[model samples]
Target chain A: MADGNEPRVFRIRVRGSDVVASCAETEKALIALEQAVAFPRPLPVNVGCRKGGCGACRVKVLSGDYTTIKMSRAHVTEQEEAEGYALACRIMPLSDMEIEPAFLSPRERMEMRQAQKFAD
Target chain B: MSQEGLLRPGIAQLRVLDMDEAVKHYVEYLGLEFVSKEDDGRVYLRAYDEFHRHSVVLREADQAGLDFFAFKADGQEAVDGFRKRIEDFGYTVDDVPAGEMPGTGARIGFTVASGHRIELYADMDLSEDAPETNSPMIWKTMPRGMRAQRMDHCLLYGPNIEEVEKFFTEVLDFHVPERVDMPDGAFAIWMTVSNKAHDIAFVKHDEPGKLHHLAFFLQDWNDIGHAADIMTHYDISRDLGPTRHGITRGQTIYFFDPSGNRNEVFSGGYTAYKDHPTRVWDHNSVGRGIFYYERQLNDAFLSVVT
Candidate 1:
């Protein structure tokens, strides 16, 4: 919900889900999502330090114009950002948006499976 | 036996949570000299006493862990030899061309049995600001922070300790100075290629490729105290220590970087010669072996990894 002074409805498309949440344009995309339920369940983005240092909350801005603050070079390389990846915690929503949170890589998936087995 | 082969631990690239906080911890607090920041946002740092262009590279990332650890071979031939040996040990080796990393030459990299990326390279440009070689003053400049002498070694946690032991000792010519064994098998091993007690250590864990801590060499016990004072002043989240490790006999302190990666500053391990007998510890006495003074492991020591 946007206040009268800032009543721009931003449609945030998370992952590949058709469900879109109507959110007010905000400085941080993550904060905007937190205010509105965009998915059936909580978004799976992992976050650590929220100050654009950890790349845990990184997502691909599939089809939206957004601005971002300076982020760490280690997580999102220049090439990655150029390819449309943005840290949700650092991005300012400017228009209706579509984002896909970075999914686990193949290596990570294997590790997760192994870890699950160990835990069991 | 070739006297000239693997010379020393050379490079370590760590994924940090915040660049600013990481810089402050590594530079202002740990006494490393800032070298340069690449366009990719990675910052290079070197200790004041080091001659290499840089030793540590910090990449701001979401998670905290080690990216890779590398050693300097005597020359290109030694690196080539290790590559062949490592490949023969049944691991794929990747050739990284020169200039892939600033100031470094070609390197051969492989993932060891412990699920850690290890690289061997033979060439790096000397730092222009390295301590003066000719008529050098002991005080090249005043050392700062805890006055860390060098990036010493790291302890990594992963599965398959027995395989890792064979890989380092049989393939890489590293020698075990100490090891812990349980009824199941070897629990942990401390290995070295040089005179230092251990160049790298590993603990048996269910998960692969976890960093325990990267240690920096401090001058002595007093320096460890100074480090503790600085940590307290800055309110750094301390994990353990200002205590002695019965394993290496190092006066040490363990603390966390803002991103939750553990960093250790330690001093005073006895010199390890290749001929020294391997010290052994059993599961029952492993706690005392790890922490000599406490004689018991801290709750966090065994569970924490980044």
Candidate 2:
């Protein structure tokens, strides 16, 4: 069990880069990433509306146990969500997570999903 | 003062993720008077200067955003008239029972074209702790935190702004005081039913029912600076300003509530006369229009909404 006083750090994998986050940080993953960016390291993904409306901080939760808050359904379709799409601003990671920015067009997303299946 | 039609921002019900944190932010930091927390855990609050029982309601929800903003009509007749006009304008208006909100009278609500739930009401029980009227003293209690005078206006983001303009202007007697013309057609409009520069504003966005910010009136530029101090001393998340807006010419500081909903405490915008021509801002100059000193739109302004 993670101690409330000493929250366990979770590694957030964004593409090839990694940013360290902790349960003690903000509940929103993008805000943790934003904190990382304050170290002057450029954030890997575009972020907007850190409250979950803009969908600019959306990413594919390639692997993770996380909780999702309500998001703009228009930006993330139910099908896309089932395929692991989640807005970073609405994602509260419960474990170390692997993610990729998912701002690609539908065809590109489809291609990436298929390639992932092929790798699987 | 406009004797009829929608008057000013009466009450705004905001959705908060944590009621305790939100109450602290709104009451302690923003300086609104805490009223009562209802059985449903919705908290009621009001500014020191307001005469009504309360003007703000915070409800704990899974999501944080505006639930609805209501305007106070002059009387029950004005409320009925607007309901008729709103219904006639092709949107369904429904009654929100008087007791639904504590001390508030019956409200006529409709989903505006901008996808915001806008309501109009006419009556509210007078506040027990209302500002002194006998000798018209400053206040019954010393103003705290940022000293918010009232819930002044809100800026909403959604699509179909052109239709929204027609809805308010034609039906509610609101007129455009300031507007921005992006290269991609209508972008933003500051509309008012009263003399204040804008009673509410709407900006075009793909999302529906997004609250850009709810503004509370401050005293003046010095108070704006003081508000900035409170925000910094308390480590509040600020989006922009202790600066002026070229559009409304108000001193403003945009910050976030604990739930990430944007809030503004501002003062000093020119009174928008009925005959005044609509001030226009082109896309190129909107940065200055929004933030007079920065001369650029912050990333947060265009993107962040709750």
Candidate 3:
């Protein structure tokens, strides 16, 4: 770690599903989502700026500590940010994390609450 | 470029955490001439080619950021005229007396919709280090470090750029040289009061009064590479570049001052004509619009500000 070649890795467990991913502190959480074997699918390569300019990779972190870069206020308001709304491309995980897509199907919302109860 | 209103970006007061490091960065690394340290502990500086006594000021502060950005008006009347226009546009205007900052004249100050303090003054003492007038050589003394020629422009991040853009063009008489119109609304704008590509630019962000970066003009593209070399040798914390901006066509590099305020060494931008049509960009090309080569913004571009 001192040599700087290796970075600490954290687990990303998507809420409402059993999907699990891993991420490093030096990369965007979206990269972890793409690398996750259990994620729904591969995120489109050209969908976002990979910079904070575009808000294509939005997510709602339910619980976790993660570092973040800047994201547009147009997409994520201060109120929304306080509520855990974030851009996946702008965040890097610090510990085991639980997140859900900003927009989820009604069925998925129900499942998330049910799963969240057990974790809490 | 017009003859009678705001002359150019003249003075900027930046807050720094450490005055010594800030002085080293601006004077030795960025090639600005250190002018004086006032009793208030603020240090003044100017580029070699700037005829004015100073174009930059550094103040010791708890955090790194911009205190205020000021423009030099053609004269007192222009400033007074703009004060009325600014107040009539729904923003309150206040006055700062002359000699508040050494040789500077009185300034009219106000906060824009974006939450940044903007000011305009009409006069400043000529620097003793100004370029020769008669039988003048190109430079009185050779430039050092990055050899920055002048204080060029700054980028600020805050909300409501549309209203900010309107305030600039309408009240300040600045012209829009380029803009990005996203589907939601005006995303960003590059505004100019002179022939240079931009005097100031703004990006839409939730936070108000955030300083994105302050840029210094270099002589040419090769000077940009020289800036990069200096950053590397001195272990300066650099953000991006030795690259070109598609919007301004400038060869540039972004780095951090000792206090974390972003700085840019820029050169080779197109001269903007007042009559020229405003260059427009959309969402799909925003990446290339900012960084021509990468065709995208780096994470730090949006997140890092002081």
Each model's number of backbone clashes? Answer: 1, 0, 2
Residues B1-306, candidate 3: write the lDDT tens digits: 336799899999998767897899899999999999999999999999889899999998765679999999988898989988998999999889989999888988999998999999999999999988899888889998999889999999888899999999988989999999999999999999998899999998877788889999999998999999999898676677889999999999988786667899999889998999999999999999999999998766766565
lDDT of each: 0.82, 0.84, 0.83
B1-306: candidate 1 lDDT, tens digit per residue: 545789889999999877898999889988999999999999999999999999999998766789999999999998888888888899999989998889999988899888899999999999988988898896577999989989999999888989999999999999999999899899999999998999999998876898889999998999999999998897675667899998988889988776657889999998888999999999889888898888988645765567
Error of 1 at A107 (Å): 16
* Per-model DockQ against the true two-chain complex: 0.06, 0.17, 0.05
TM-score of chain A of each: 0.69, 0.72, 0.70
Which candidate, 2 or 3, would have the higher lDDT against the true structure? 2
**Pick by lDDT: 1 or 3, better one:** 3
User: How high is each candidate's TM-score?
Assistant: 0.74, 0.82, 0.74
Candidate 1: misplaced stretches above 4 Å? A1-120
Shift of residue B46 alpha carbon in model 3, Å: 0.5
Model 3: per-residue Cα lDDT over A1-120, one tens digit each: 337789988888777666677788787787677676533353432124344433445689999998787565544556667889887777898888888867432234336545665876
Candidate 3 collision pairs: A70-B303, B287-B295
Q: Candidate order by TM-score, highest to lowest? A: 2, 1, 3
Pick by TM-score: which candidate is best?
A: 2
